[model samples]
Target: MLRSAARSYSTKIRSAVRVPNESYIKDKKVTFDRSFPVQKRTKAWEKDGMDKGEWFKKNYAHVHARQKSERAINGDNDPFDKRSKHYERIKQEGSYKREQFRNHRSEYTRAHPLQGLKPNPLIDYVYGTNSVLSALLAKRREYFVKVSHYGPLNTQIQSLCNKNNIQVEETEKHRLNLLTNYGVHNNIVLECKPLQPPELSHLGVVNSEGSTYDKVEMDYDQSVNTRDKFMTKENKKFPLGIYLDEVVDPHNVGAIIRSAYFLGADFMILSHKNCSPLSPVVSKVSSGTMELLPIFTCAKPLQFFEKSKEEGGWTFVASHLSGSKSKTHLTLNELSGMLNELPVVLVVGNEGNGVRTNLLNRSDFTVEIPSGRNPEEARNTIDSLNVSVATALLINGFAN
Candidate 1:
């Protein structure tokens, strides 16, 4: 039995391990042979003895011509041809639509010239909860429209609107954003007439002793007493005022006004030509302080300065850099000593350019804030503070 089992195992091993066929091995070897013939490749320049660049130029034109002929024959059967045609059609359609829109816009603009071309000056939009509430309470501007708001309106705001017979409407935040020209609206906007402050001449005369002006006439619905309250005799005694010399940034204008009003400034004078307008933005940034402060417009600031110095007994103190080239210079500590000597007007200048050279020359005192760094260190670093910040420091120094 052992011999028979051995024979059967040998037979099974031989059958499982069959040898490869000689012809099949030879055929497989031939299929992978590295000695196979390869066609010689040569450039046109090599074949025709032409310049490499010229040969390539000719070859490029010939290749493109062949491709063009092939595309004409194959038409949309070629994937590239089909894709290019599809893109061309889409581009043409887009251009045609754009042209149509441009023509339509032109016609609409021609038909309605004044509607959207310019902003309406009579109506203004005031936003922010504090600003809107303040405008409603101030009653300096006429309110004939509704208050648009998003989310829950403030209780005080809703109550004021109701008391004033102004309507309140719930609106989307986007509408509020549009109304405020994307300003920081705080989700509430009020529509009202623009607040127009009276000029310095219209309000009263500036005398050497003090504000010897008559009672301000109330042209609008504003009470005469309210106007008179700001210009009282006590407030004008040794009064401190701010003169904005071509300060055109609305934000800086608003901020300076806010600081001045908070620090008990008597009045503000704005240059008529270059100063920022008392727009809604100024009111919003000022936190409605613009409504409370007494503002006067001076068309010619140099003349106003001359007149104030000669006749009004006002001292002009200009905020200057620490090492400015002004003839008269005073440190903040020095400026404090003379705050009560006479009526003072603190002149702050434009953001880019400092106080105009002429204004600096005209100023009686040019005040500068002392830097924490020494002169050498301060010269190497940021040498000056922002006009608004410097103005606040000067105002604080004078006020205290």
Candidate 2:
């Protein structure tokens, strides 16, 4: 019986084992195909019976000369080599630096905690006291993230979550803490859905020409304000919109949103390239003002503004180092005077490199807030203002 069992076991093991392919197991003999071979040009030196190594050295004499010109590198403590240790010491130091850099980078990945999204980063987590409550109250998103447990703000979010049919996990609080990087969760962290922007068909005003509104994914409460002529309002609040031309900073964008919303700006347009997305950080920094502001994104912001100028009669004014781009020394005061002429669109550019040349050319006017400095004074005194601060200033002027 034991002998029969052993035979069966051996047979089973053999069946389970995988054998390598015959081709893979065989020794590989690599050979180049001679069928497609091209004839090589024979040099005069080869015909003269020159050795290949000697021919190479003679033909590439300049390369050899460069090697001879370089200072000899010696191992440390080589007594016979009297040459200065400058280059060798430098090479050794450089090698040490390279090794140190490799180790530093290896440790960097371990210490920095990986910046981008994890496969599952809890979808999104909106934590502060106000952000948590506002996220729940806004109801702009489909449903707030369901939590197995609640922190200090549980009573507040419970009903809101239930009404929205948000799921409930009923897990412990420590998991929530880990999700937020131990932030002051206030006993609430929302793994909520993003606000789905209303479709373009449902947005924008129907122009007199009646068709040709290309759809773009935009965030803004259309029901709260409007889809069209949030541009033209009766309260003398002319359409005051802003285009962020590649403003990459989320903090800046968020602060600008808060400023724009509070200072009476209507909507915002974001360029597709070199710009930050409407992430959770933007929403958090805006203190929930992002929900209130109407944001439109366009692949070609320059073209969109141009079209608005020709068809929709919207005036796109690009804010720059100096509003000197326009032929007529156009000033902010001029924009105030021309307010009734057309809806205003202010284009704030990247922080370092103002607005792009093409965009500035498309503008109906240019605005440059003069540095409050003397003619000879260094720019350090006051070269430019923060984009958010600048936007606030412009919005305030438009609001008045």
Candidate 3:
């Protein structure tokens, strides 16, 4: 019976491979012209394809009628109207083609599993009918928002969500599986903010809450610990304050955060206006270190610095290239001698500019790195090290 089954399978495979003889016209000598056409001028067409008079008789009437219709509608052959129509047609065609391509690609990707391709995140927060975006802004101090309600570009967000374990919620009518658990009260709502800000505009109509009271719930107040409570946490060692001037590079920020976390720095603080905290780029670069680090942003960096200093901590600058015999120039042993008594707060500044003068003056000490023979050459080339590399050096130096 097994041998008979095998023979039957082989026969079926052979039959499936067979093609009908009528599919190819024997007289055409297996020509590709029917399958795929290539444009060319034939000898007959080259020799007087068709007489001008005959061509005019056949096609001129239709051409003239079209021109007359154009004149009747637009009063002249301006060409702009035709151009606009042409562009519109092209745009529609392009859109259709793109949509078809996307569908095919999506189907292909769904069929084939790739290890590197990230999975979609579960929805931690969902907005329907109510101003969920507005609520997010109001409670910005509480939660580390992973994705903003930018628009329907959730795919980009999905990659990040998968990496950091974030949740996504949508209020579209078709989607029956609404994330109503956790802080989400209900996805059903009627009267919500119809418009959203440029950054958070995606949540405007796609998913809105009908009842205002049900939609305004916030997770930050429940999730994060209060300042006093956070302070009282057991073994809260090395609560060093970090102040960023204009460090916009998220990768650098993430690396610095990783260094701080590993070197026993418990907390980090940033300038509220100048820096972005809990951004996806930073999260990805840090590789889950952001979750470990307690990040705080203050309105006034200088005031925060002073407060940290007054709390038995010493503020020091890491940039040693500045003129004058700055403590920034001190060796690890020398620096350790200075920091042994006081809780040290190390300040690494922006990529282009070093720390500001006012902050520099107030700092307890300024340290510098030793340079090459020609001080000018060293100073010029000294700008080459990445902020992350410099951070590693500074953190390891302090920990050692």
Which candidate number maximizes TM-score? 1
**Candidate 1, lDDT over the whole model:** 0.75
Tens-place lDDT digits, model 3, residues 1-400: 9999999898777564656486555654665676896897665323667866776667578877777788778766653468778899999999999999999898755231213333334223333322233223333223334433323533433554455454554445323222222122233211112111111000011011121100011133432212211121122223344556567787788788877777656356565566655543454456546655655555555665564455334445554455576434555446543323334556777776767777777777666555445656644745436766766676666555
TM-score of 1: 0.63
- In order, what lDDT does every prediction score? 0.75, 0.66, 0.49
- Give candidate 3's error at residue 55 in angstroms: 22
Which of the predicted structures, 1 or 2, would earn the higher TM-score when compared with the native? 1
Residue 234 of candidate 2: its Cα lDDT?
42
List the candidate numbers ranked by lDDT, top first.
1, 2, 3
Tens-digit lDDT string for candidate 2 (31-67): 5664568889998678968988888878898875555
Candidate 1 residues lying further than 4 Å off, grouped into runs, are: 1-119, 201-237, 322-327, 374-381
**lDDT score, candidate 1, position 48:** 99
Give the higher-lDDT candidate: 1 or 2. 1
What is the clash count for each candidate, in the order shown?
0, 4, 22
